[model samples]
Target: MTDEPALDSARKPVPAGTPDADSAAAPWWTRAVVYQVYPRSFADSDGDGVGDLGGIRAKLGYLAELGVDAVWLSPVYPSPQHDNGYDIRDYQDIDPVFGSLAEFDALLAEAHERGIKIVMDLVVNHTSDEHDWFQESRSSRTNPRRDWYWWRPAAADGGPPNGWRSAFSGPAWTLDGATGEYYLHLFARQQPDLNWENAEVRRAVYAMMNWWLDRGVDGFRMDVINFIAKRVELVDGPRPSVDGGSPMGPQIHDYLQEMHREVFAGRGGEHLTVGEMPGVSVSDAVLFTDPARAEVDMIFQFEHVSLDQGEHKFHALPLSLPALKKSLSRWQDGLADTGWNSLYLNNHDQPRLVSRFGNDSEYRYESATLWALVLHLHRGTPYIYQGEEIGMTNVRFDSIDDYRDIESLNHFREAVQEFDRSPAAVLAGVHTMGRDNARTPMQWDASDNAGFTSGTPWIAANPNFPGINTVADRAGERSIFRFYQRLIALRHESPVVALGAFSMLEPEHEQLYAFTRTLGDETLLVVANASDAPLVGPLPVDVTGGDLVLGNYAGADGSGLRPWEARLYRL
Candidate 1:
């Protein structure tokens, strides 16, 4: 399915609430606020300079107090650190840098004890070349596990099997002299794409998933899940393509259905499964998330976040607020009937929200608070990336040498060395969209290293952490952290915020993102001045009888909204 129209709510028999009757029973994930913990950057307990499970365990109380129902830990599994844990070396064990299995268990126990669930990052599309399976597959062509990863003879022209290129800017196929074959890798060469067509591979994946489920992992945030099934014929991608978008393969649904049958069938609907779909449209997301099909509960779509990127993520442009409203409103309506959306402004993969989307300098507090109101008040589940609750801004290192992300390093190399691009422009782009922006250490206090570690950190902490940290924010009553707490509390208290029918109020307004959330007789108006300038608009209807439910500022002036003001009203 391509881009389907916004779901028709009139066809629904259930009261006009969020989702259908099937998913509305969503015991947890529906209205839950999920906090994503980049394990390596969260907090370093033992002073190994890297964050560990012990650190997360010690901080469970903080997350519980933050009002989040769950924490989505970005891959803590064993890896060679090639892609900061995405290139998984072991699926079952915790990385030594993070901690051991015992520590993970303790962390999980503490999280659950505090009424918080933990969902693991599932990276099934590929595995680290150092993994035993990949090692065995690469050992010999006749090995039983040789087909575990995609392997093929070189093309007639003595090149890769197809014109495929890696998402990080290299040939997608890597030649292995030992076997005289090319293996496909959409990412780093060390991350070989798995041969999902092989039933053994599928079974192995299913078994791994079951192991996690039985081990009490509440759910999974499957990474690049849409790329699990590629075009079986191995046809070349479109000309001059970069292997970045979601792989729209014909057998994708079949594989998902099989996965559900084998892994999620008897588990019931309590588990949350959110697919991180890179290029999936609104309609495809519906197919993936409709609970009746037992596929997934929600999906993280990239279109809205990608609006500011010009063609590539590295090339940045000022975002258009109206366009952003149009895109977000479509998804809100598109999935109103069949599925749900995962709301986020920042994550481990993207830049910080205040830096990229909101005004981070003069009106940082107001803008960040405005964002908290806008994102959490939406129709679907909301995700708060580590440090986003405190309004963490992007970091700009003096040079690229300080950057550790493989994607950033690779693109910087391509930009300066191969393309003859100006280093200044390239560096600026990296500062704007680099994954390192969100990878900075969590700012907990004003002490050395932001109190993240007693020793040197693996990555440098943002220099501005002293002022924009948890301790500082907590001391100050009206800070971004407190605003986020209020937002989460609203989600728990107001069913109108949880299951309201979403509709954009003033779609044509340039600097205003105004929308209405309706649930039966209650209708809540959400208006935010998404810019640094005051906005004056005509009052089409008087909001006299409504209660001023939530706002960043205390008193309403009645005439207009000040710069970066966000308010919610319920009638």
Candidate 2:
């Protein structure tokens, strides 16, 4: 602790709206727009209720025409569905529910033929208790694989190992009767945290990753990548987040560096790696992506996404535009020079951006267009969750039992037992902001199961299917799907958006978020109306005659913007 570590400068607070001066080396992630596919809800080949690889394969043509450079597929690995495929039983095998390995290989081949890369989910931090590795590790303390996971003796007070609590609302350590020891799990009991301290564990993970690369995949979307390394001392973390849960251990970074050296370094040109580093600071992130270390190419920062949570759990709070702007700007600037950044508003773990950030009731299309403009035109690689192009909304659940997300159920139980909250109140929160929000079946059309399957869907579809289906949007020239298609095409065609530097024009304004990207002599300006009313602001940087690139509002005839309208100008 005394060394402070060189490159050990003060962690300057990242200002909102500007990229840092030090971020010169971070590659051209700004121009990238990656589409995220949630396999279970994406598409189903057979009449099965679940989506599969064949379904994804059938849609690559749609994605290719959409013009995104990459597709980030959520976990398709073998799992017990404890955390919706995050709890991996096997890293290398395809889940029978999703499809077989041959089908996945076909997806990789097809995506590559279309010049689109693939980023597979890597869940290395923990594995399902059903996984052979974990089964053997937990069998007995004397087993050769016993040290593969974090197993500690009970505390003096008869509590589990430490005061650490799971992210899903329980003690982080679960008791193992056979060994009379408690094993750590930041998530579910089925997902025991891997002991990164074990050289064998690190090697196994690296070997598994190389196997994927050899199979023709382009990169990996590492799940909770930073949590792999635990603090050796195993000290208790700070008091739980307001409703009560301790912070994840601190030593996670040290393990991350080793992971980079052993796994991601040699695959730079052939493959890219993005770490889902949730608890890292900007300066610390530099260490992970620093070219010298080769730990990873970019990281999915959560500062912006987590703002809505406030003092409660992630799904309990409401979206705040001001808070979002602050969070996005900080990360945009903090990693500006030191590392690369991964931008996204909706993912499998969060609610749909349309429902959470914009007016999802009357103006779903307009609002989703606005959210897309704000994130896609920013300084990082934009990621689009499946069904986002057509503006999907949240999944409504009648009871907590109807929900399948472990985290959501855990929170519901916590609210009732700890806060003595009413069941209605818990359900209300879940309705507004649950992980299941983005898990609904993709609305391909108004047909059966929204065209995701001929049979019943595993999860309920949003009731607004008649209006928001992809078929309707594709047929209409002015639909949200078409707007997204144009935006992605324009980004690749315009240097201002693809290679330009980002400069914020209005950072403090409540209703207006404006920025400009300048590449050589070509400059592009993007103005977004983030409110529910009209906003009129002067064009900050002097501009002459300009061509309107894309406008979500009906009145873009040089007039002010309407609510949730986004406009792009080439000056």
Candidate 3:
């Protein structure tokens, strides 16, 4: 909130190309690359259209060879597919769509056997209305479990409790016919927000997490974990929020501290926990991930990704490189002392990085690899979403009927029907910003169905998969997949890459991104030209000669960079 949280008072600024390492305790994940597997689209062993655990298990060898230290799976729990698998019905068992618990156990055992860890998805903020807890809570006014969810009587004139809108659009509070009450849902009406104010709810969530940890899993990637606590007296938002309700609440720390004490206090394995928090700030993230607090290892913040989203996610603008640089640098400096950071560009709910930020058409491979070096070289743990290694592009939907995401559909309807906009114009927005762009089936090979399945796929494979399949890339020595492998290897082999302090070299440059990382006597300079045109820049004048450690362009030498070019130098 203050201009920026002051840097650790004792630390001094290091030179542009110098190493700065403090004697801080480092964890395995700090130096590890995490790959996220969206189970529904990762791979399908059976002939069914949907991907399952067996599919993921079959790909474990591929992931291992990709050089990721851990695999973070999107939720595999039972759900009604309202928001994909985010609306959970049961946390203890595996969803039938994703195979049984035995398959999950098999996947875990095999992953551990390959020296890779498996992290589970933790969706504790809310649950499906079909969940027994919600069913009972909505059954009657005085049911024993009624208080487990947020429920209130309809307004005097018969309406929702307040003006809070659902995250997917429309009213956040849904009317219950039987009980004549309005139940709250930040997401879809089916996903009623659980009352974290209830001690019983917290106990239940912690117990579910313990169950997963006891099952030999590594840890959790908590979904919207910060939205758990609501204002004691639910007040109407001053303005309607796209996703509804307040985020980064004041009591989030208290709830997280209590949850940490109750669940993760005595856990033996060095589990990795990263919360997917959209509305969190750098200062709040510091408290959430501070080592002493033990609430979580890190959090996924949306500042950088949301910079281009004007007003609402559906409305987007051309991304300014300077703005992106500022966002990343702020977090890098803010959490440098007390906490850690999670770096990513693509996820289940976001468009692919290559399409959204980098060039996906002409210089796809170059831009994708450039972005990878930019983020992976940062002072944080980097995550790779499925298909990212092979440079997947955003999807193009022909019609609203082809879209399955609730948020996308709602926005489409409102844009065309309510706002009286042209259907073509609305469709253009959805095509550009919809979550379905990331949800398209993963491109595995050039065979029928892109080798993702023998049968039809639940979602259509990207038409470009033929040129971008994993099989083709893995066979080529100079493919994007191989480049990612080398990047991960560098992070593991060089402690300087993992531990060096981060300082920006050219913060305001439009096409050029340059930064230095320093630890001990080792200093490295990373520069990327995130544009189609060549860029010229000088090497820092600090009497420096350096080795070209890694580069996207062949024989890339000093003084300048080509289009979408990136180079890492060891000084």
Q: Which one wins on TM-score?
A: 1
How many backbone clashes can be found in candidate 2?
4
TM-score of each: 0.95, 0.91, 0.94
> Residues 307-328, candidate 2, lDDT per residue (tens digit)?
7775665445655666667777
Best by lDDT: 1
Instruction: Assess the local accuracy of residue 376 in candidate 1 as a C-alpha lDDT between 0 and 100.
Output: 84
* Candidates 1 and 2 compared by lDDT, better number: 1
Q: Can you write out model 1's per-residue Cα lDDT over 1-571, one digit (the tens) per residue?
A: 2122122222122323643434445446666899999999999999989998989998888898889999999999999999999999999999999999988888888888898999999999999999999999999999999999988887777888777778888898899999999998989999999989899999999899999889898989999998888876544433334443445586787887777777766565567788987788898988887765657778999999989989788999998988898999999889887878899998999999998888889988889989889988888899999999998999999899999999999999998999999988999999999999999899999999999999999989999999999989878967888888889998888777778788887888888888888876778888888988888864434677778888888798445788999988886
**Model 1 local distance difference test score:** 0.85
In model 3, which regions exceed 4 Å deviation? 1-24, 236-248, 540-544
- Expressed as tens digits, the lDDT of each residue in 1-571 for candidate 3 is 1222222322222222234333334667767899999988989999798999999999888998899999999989999988889999998999998999998899999999999999999988889989999999988999999999988877656777667777898888888899988888888988999988889998898888888888998988988888887765554333333344464457788887777676666564277888888778898888888766657788999999999998789888999999999999999999887778899999988988999999999899899999999999998889999999999999897888988889999998987788899999888888889998988888999988789899988888888888889998889766899999998998888877776788887788899898988887777889899999988766442325788888998986667789999988887
Candidate 1, number of clashes: 0
RMSD of each: 4.1, 4.8, 4.7
- Residue 110 CA displacement from its true place in model 3, Å: 0.3
Q: Which portions of model 1 show Cα errors greater than 4 Å?
A: 1-24, 236-246, 539-541
Question: Candidate 1, 231: how far from true, in Å?
Answer: 0.9
**Candidates' lDDT values, in order?**
0.85, 0.77, 0.84
Using lDDT as the measure, what is the rank order of every candidate, best first?
1, 3, 2
